[model samples]
Target: MSEDDEDFAGCRPLLFTIAYEILGSAADAEDVVQDSYLRWHAVRGKGIGHPRAYLVRTVTRQALNHLRAARRRREEYVGPWLPEPVRTAPDVSEDVVLAESVSMAMLLVLETLGPDERAVFVLREVFGYSHREVAGLVGRSEATVRQIAHRAREHVRARRKRFHHDPGTAREVVGRFLSAAGTGDVGTLMSLLAPGVVHVSDGGGLVSAARRPVAGRERVARFVAGVARRSAPGTRFDITSCNALPAVLFRVGDRIDQALVFEISGGLVHGMYAVGNPHKLGAAVTPRLLSRKGHETWKP
Candidate 1:
């Protein structure tokens, strides 16, 4: 086996972890990891030790570059921008880490940080990298890295109370949310939402959506009930896990029309991310029951 191949294999998991932390989108994270590998190979013929650290640095830098551009684009975004949701593996050995690293709430909060600050925080806190290591990776002095990380920490701490939902409880809450939405039951939906729950939909201007985030249980409930009515007759919905939390997927005539990813806190729905853009649905896989052509099936 080539040295580069061995090194890449050893660092794949860590690379995904770092990318996910920085970008908060599994699809984007995978793209960044692939890009990192290409860059690694381009320089592979050159002798280098500590391949693991080298890969980490390369991936982290690529993620930071993406974050820089993403931040600029979001400033003028049509509406609330949300991180892409991911489906968790059934066995969640890293549930706690995922809670902190991949939560929708944490990712949204990360949007407040500068690219460099986000990189430093992810490297030091999420990956356990030392200040010196982060400094070297980010091309900053150790003291500067320390300061950036500290500032990022304070920013995150200010929003910590907003992300205190247990993953298990969040799953149950989402299930109830889907049930309420499916039956067009406003009371049930209102009961599940926190008094000040926020609903942010990203139709990307291609479809109808709120121009800004809709806050308050009554508003969110009314919006969801209206959505339930527009769904094509015989349309089916399922509550599935996405991005390490529970989410609802709407299927119409075999095509997945929408996926509603959420953030729960204090046993109530605290945040709502509705992804209706067809482009965003590219990563969604067909459910097993619908695999066969003409099957016309949907399952929760």
Candidate 2:
């Protein structure tokens, strides 16, 4: 490989992670990384002293631009919009902070932040970038970055309170919940859900799903059972890790029909995010490796 290629290749995982956390879409993250690489290729020979820092700055800017441009589309989206699920390796769960940062609930919270705030918060909070570094990456003054970071941190801290369950207990609960839902066992489902459980489905108006969140254990259980009863024949469910947590992937024939990721706490399911949009299923077919400390070895 050329010297330029080697430098960018070495930082691809970290770059992709930064972009994904900022953009909340693996596909878009990959695109941003690729775009960054092309830009790097064009400028690498111009006495670049720090390849990783430069690449990260490029990716952060690209992702911020993308997020700003996507706001209108997301605002107009039909039904509830959920972040695209990314299948993650088991080792990712070993890092509690890393795992929680990528969870659907966390991503949804991030969606509430403005583009610049999200970019600053992710670099400062999730990736441990210094305030000066974050300011450089996002093209803001140090004081501005700090203020945005503080505000963004406060917002995330206030809203990010799901999916802190014990892994073993969470897996067991998810397994049983899936079985009960698949079999239309409302009684068992009710026993497994929290009294205030909330279920949100995002089909993007391209598939069948609840346009609004279904709340309460009884309502969620019945909704889950009803959906199961309406599922087409030959549908298969595979329990796997998504965003470093246990999740269900529903397949129809050879296509992924939906993904169900739970927010488990107190040994019971408290929040459920069902993503049925086909556009967001790319990660389900091919898991992406993630790293917070430049340790990821997965290519593509």
Candidate 3:
């Protein structure tokens, strides 16, 4: 690859990640990353003091702008909008910042902030950019950036739950829930949920799913179980890794249906996020999975 192409290649992951976190859509993030790369190419070898920082700045600004437009679209969204579930590698489980930042709960909290606040928080809090660097990237005074950072930090802190990563506990909880669900055992499923458990499903109007968050232990349990009982006769479920945590992947024939991710607290499941939006699933699922006929086989 040429030097400029090489530079873009080296920084692509960081750029895409920043965009994804800010916009909550891998598809939008990909567009932002590509736009940033083009800008980088145009200004390449122009005595840029640090290419990496420049790329970060470019990607962050692009993402923030995209986020502004996205907020408007979200107002018109047909159902509860969840962050696109991106497949994370195993090593992400060990990175505390990554694990916490990408969690469904955290992303939902981030959604509460303004575009600028989200950008500052992602750059200053999650990615560890200095206040001055973030100010330069977002074109705000360092003092202003610091103030925004503090506000954003507190906003997220107040809303986001502090989750202790317990992979062993998570795996066990997910396994038990899956077994209970597959057997259509509502009582067993209810026993596994926390008293104030919540279930959120994202279908993005392209498939079948709950339009609003299902709250309460008994309601959430039955919500999950009712869907479980409606699965196709030969539907198969597998325990797999998704978003750096143990999750259950449902499949029917060759089509990957959905990924059910559970959030555990103490010994019970506190939150369940079912991502059935074929658009959100992206290339991770087969073409068959996106078909309306396939999606009708079950719900979550």
The per-residue C-alpha lDDT of model 1 at residue 254 equals 82
| Tens-digit per-residue lDDT, 51-87, candidate 3 | 7777777888888888999999999887889887776
Candidate-wise lDDT, in order: 0.73, 0.87, 0.79
Off by over 4 Å in 2: 295-300
Each prediction's RMSD to truth: 8.0, 2.6, 8.3
**In candidate 1, residue 183 scores what lDDT?**
83
- Which candidate do you rate higher for TM-score, 2 or 3? 2
TM agreement with the true structure for every prediction: 0.85, 0.95, 0.90
Off by over 4 Å in 1: 1-3, 162-171, 284-300
Model 3 residue pairs with clashes: none
Q: What TM-score number comes out for model 3?
A: 0.90
Candidate number of the best lDDT: 2
Candidate 3, position 159, lDDT: 91
